[model samples]
Target: MIGICKSFGANKVLGGVNLHVRPGEVHALMGENGAGKSTLMNILTGIHRADAGTIMVDGKEVTFKNNKDAEEHGIAFIHQELNIWPNLSVLENLFLMNQPKTRFGTIDFKKMREMAEAKCQEIGIDLPLDEIAGECSVGQQQMTEITRSLMLDAKTVIMDEPTAALTERETDRLFEVMKKLKNKGVSIIYISHRMEEVFANCDTITVMRDGQTISSRPTEETNMDQIVGDMVGRIMSEYYPARTNVPGDEIFRVEGFTQPGVFRDISFNLRKGEILGVAGLMGAGRTEIMRAIFGVDPHESGKLYFEGKEIHIKNPRDAIRHGFGFITENRKTEGLILDFSIERNIALPSEERLAQSHVINDKKEFDFSSELSKRLGVKAQDINLPASTLSGGNQQKVVIAKWVGMHPKLLILDEPTRGIDIGAKKDIYDLMNELTAKGVSIIMVSSELPEVIGMSDRILVIHEGRAAGIVEHKDATQTRIMTLATGGE
Candidate 1:
């Protein structure tokens, strides 16, 4: 793509940007959220038309009017949000518009299943073709999306945050897949915020900032410091903020928590002003345990204590009433109402506080949301814009703001910084420090070992629905955590 220019009303999203990817090379696209990375990709994939630009394929200039047109040119996009039909079976989703037909003009179920199975084998994975797409894990769904692109015979594939929801082992598998694609001479446009992944897997790096290309260099020539500085236009001295709040006496504790076939005998204590980090592999029950504590899921048996007094929490409302807040892992599905305005989402959790005599005060709601937006640095035209309009980082800030408005004593953050840019991650870490300073306890569940070590006062390792052990920040090493997470003592 050459001289790509795009605008959305008054917002000039891309200002004369350019990108070049070679065949069989994994090119990494680096940028903060809203830096026009998605806009550029959208223009390239024909999701949106560029105001002024030229796309050259095989040294021939071509214009694409729609996604299908781009696909015809062997270009495919696997979006960050996997665009699989939840109600449809895996085979059905894979061959939705391009199913094989028999001599009688009927869809060929046997052919479709055979093709799906062959594709999975080519990618070195096993997937049930008849299973519902929604029933599959995030990693499996990702593989299905990739298989679809390959089935289209795509020469140029674009993956946006492909491994954001994947576990460490799953990420390794994805890297292997990418390598196989490269060996087959297929070009890949890799977009991600994880610097480690970029350096480890990509052959070239392209940095974008403020809607324009800053620099593009070979992976061998550029380092993480240079790439990060170029992307964010600043030198990040420290990735995590200093922990200032000293933990106080135990304020929350769960004893013998058992959720059949989920987690069992989970026991832990959270102190005031403490940040307790939860570490585990995917499917190890880290999220399930937190869900039980927050009353989103019921445990078969458990004893909960708050400030040394036993308490009962039968549902989310009960937990919320007792000053508990939860930031779910999948923000798009569970955290925010995509169709609602920013102000409305911010006021959702605190509706009772913003109500008077069983009626909501619109003005008060607006005022509170406005204040929270400013406090959280949510970038938007106004508070009345739909929550879906904001970028990933801003959307995440809205979720945090919603819970912060409720002034909860204990906050549960599940994958808090997942898919966010590095700059936004720093802002969240700072916010966590500030919140803890005010005596708000935090329980953070993260798959990133570096983050868990950098931010947590204590790290609790969970292995296959059981607590392996808890390690102090000073003693928490990646190897130690991995050992415990893999069921070692």
Candidate 2:
């Protein structure tokens, strides 16, 4: 694509952007959340039309009418969000709207099974073909999407944050498959926020900022600092900010937190002003434990205490009433209402406080939301814009602002910075320090080991739904945490 330009009303998403991918090469696309990467890809796949641009596929200029048209032209896009049908089986999902038939006009289940098994074996992934897609883990669902894309035999495949939901072992398997595909003369457009993965796996790198291409260089020619500098337009002196908040006496404790078949014997504690990092492999019940503690899900047996006194939480309202806030992992669905304005979403939890005699005070709500949004450094034209209009980083800031407005003693942040850029990540870390300084304890559940080690005063490693070990900041290392997370001693 050359000179691609797109506009969404007054917002110019892509401004004369350019991208060139060689055949059989892994090209990495690096950018902040609103850097026009997604918009460019959407235009390539015909999800949106470019105001001005030209695309050349195999030296022939052509335009795609839709994603299906792009697929027909040997270009496939695997979105970050898995497009799996929850009610259908894995096999059914793999062949939805595209299935082979026998001479008698009947679906060929045998052929589908054989093809799926072959693809799974080739990718070194084991998926239950007959199981419901909804019943599978996020990693499994991601693999299902990858397998479906590979089945298309496309020449160019666009992958957006493919490993976000995968385990270390699964990620290794995916890289192996990517290598094999490259050897087969297939081109790949890799989009991710992981600097290490991009540097290690990709052959070339392209950075975009504010709807324009900043630079495109060979992976060997460019360094991380330069790429980060180009993306955020500044040099990051430090990736994780310093923490000065000293943890006080234990203010929250959980004893023998169990959820029967899900998790068992989960136990931990949090100090008055501390960030406790929870680390584990995907599907290791880290999220489940937090969900149960926050009353979003039930626990069969557990004991909760706050300020040295026993307490009971049967639901989220009770948890909130007792000064607990939970920022869920899936922010789009559980954290904020996309259609609601930023002010409304931020003021959601504080409705009772912002109301008088069962009626809301619009001015108070607006002022409260405006203050928190500015405090969190949420970048928006106006507070009345819908939450969906903000970038991922800004959306996350809104979620934090919403919970922070409630003045919770203990805040649970699950995957707090999952899909944001490095610049935004530093902003969040700084905000966390500010909150901790103000005496708010935090329990952060994360998959990124560096984040766990960087921000946590103490790290809890969960293995197979059990508490493997808890290591202090001075004693924590990626290897040690990974060992404990994978059922090591």
Candidate 3:
């Protein structure tokens, strides 16, 4: 992308944004939320057209009329959100657009399978030739996505948060594959909010802030703190603040938490002023346990104790009745109603607090949402603006603020800071510390190991639906956590 300019109505999301990639290099796009990184990629991949720009592909300038044109031009964009159909077989999803067959009205299953097998072999994926895509794990699904791009001869592959849902070993495998691609002269444009990944795997780095390119430099020439400072143009003094409150009596406890084929025999406690962390790989039962506790998922056997008495939470309503709140992992879908106003989405769970005469109190609703929005530092055009219009980091803050207004005795956040920029992450860490200081016990589930170590007073490590081990604040080592996470415990 060079001299790119794009606007959504009056908002100039991309203003003269410029990026480039070499034939055998990984170019990383780093930015705070809403820095026009996605917008620029959208333009390049024909998801959106630039107001004015020129794209140089292999020393030739090109313009794509649409996504199909971009694909034909040898560019493939894997969105931050996975787009594969779960119910379809892997072969079908791989050759989704155009299938190989003889010139006949009937489908060609034999030739399609043959070609899919060849492609999967070249890409090092070992999924069954006819395995259902949905039944596979997230890491396998991502590999399918990558193989799909290669089958189309996508010379320049663009991956957006491809490893966000992957395990440590899976991430290592992905990096290895990317290195092979680099050696084969396949340029990759990697976009991610994870600074460590960018620094580790990318050759060049470009930082964007507020729809502008802040800086672009060679990875070896810059450090993490400098790049972070450039991305948000600030020096973050402290990330996770020290908690001020004393740990009180246990506010919530779960014993014998069990969900058939998911997780079983789990027990944990949340003190009134403690931040308890849950750490594990993807599908390791961290999220499952949280969902079961919050009554979002089914539980065959478990005992949930709130305050002191055991409560049977048949649904989310019962969880709420027991003063429970959850911030889901999939923020775009599970957390917020995108089309609704930020204020409206934030006020959704708290409507009962302001209802009078079988009617919602609009004034109180707006007031509460507005106050929380301000307190959480949610960046938005207005409270009435649609939640979809906000940036990723701001949207996350809105989600947190929504539940904070509910005043739950226990709040559970699953991957609360995924895909958010470092500045916003520090802000969130500060917010978490503040919440814990106020006697609001927190149960946070995060895959980022550093965050698990930094924020939690204690951590519960799970694997294959069982509690592997537990560690205190200062004693948890990444090596120890990984051992238990991979089933060593």
Report, for all candidates in order, the number of backbone clashes. 0, 0, 0
Q: Tell me the whole-model lDDT of each prediction, alpha carbons only.
A: 0.91, 0.92, 0.85
Question: Which candidate leads the pack in TM-score?
Answer: 1
lDDT score, residue 119, model 2?
A: 90
Give per-residue lDDT, candidate 2, residue 427: 83
Candidate 3 local lDDT, residue 326: 97
Q: Write the per-residue lDDT of candidate 1 for residues 1-489, one digit (tens) a residue.
A: 999999889988899998999999999999999899998988888889999989999899988898889998999998887789999988898997899999999999999988888878877777778889999987778777877877887889999999987777768878898999899889999999998999999999999998999999999998988888998899987889888789999999999999989999999999999999999999999999999888988899989999788999999999999999999988888899999999999999999999999899999999999999999888898899999988877888999999999999999999999889999899899999999999999999998999999999999999999999999998999999999999887
Tens-place lDDT digits, model 2, residues 1-489 = 999999988978888998999999999999987788888998999988889989999899989999999998899899986789999999988888788898999999999999899999988889899999999988899999998999899999999999988888889999999999999999999999999999999999999999999999999999999999999999987899988889999999999999988899988889988999999998899999999998999999989999999999999999999999999987877999999999999999999999999899999999999999998888788999999988766888899899999998999999998878888788889988988999999999999999999999999999999999999999999999999988888
Question: Which candidate would rank higher by lDDT, 2 or 3?
Answer: 2
Alpha carbon RMSD to native, model 2: 1.8
Segments of candidate 3 deviating more than 4 angstroms: 128-136, 382-392
The root-mean-square deviation over C-alpha atoms between each candidate and the true structure, in angstroms, is 1.1, 1.8, 2.1
Error of 2 at 284 (Å): 2.1
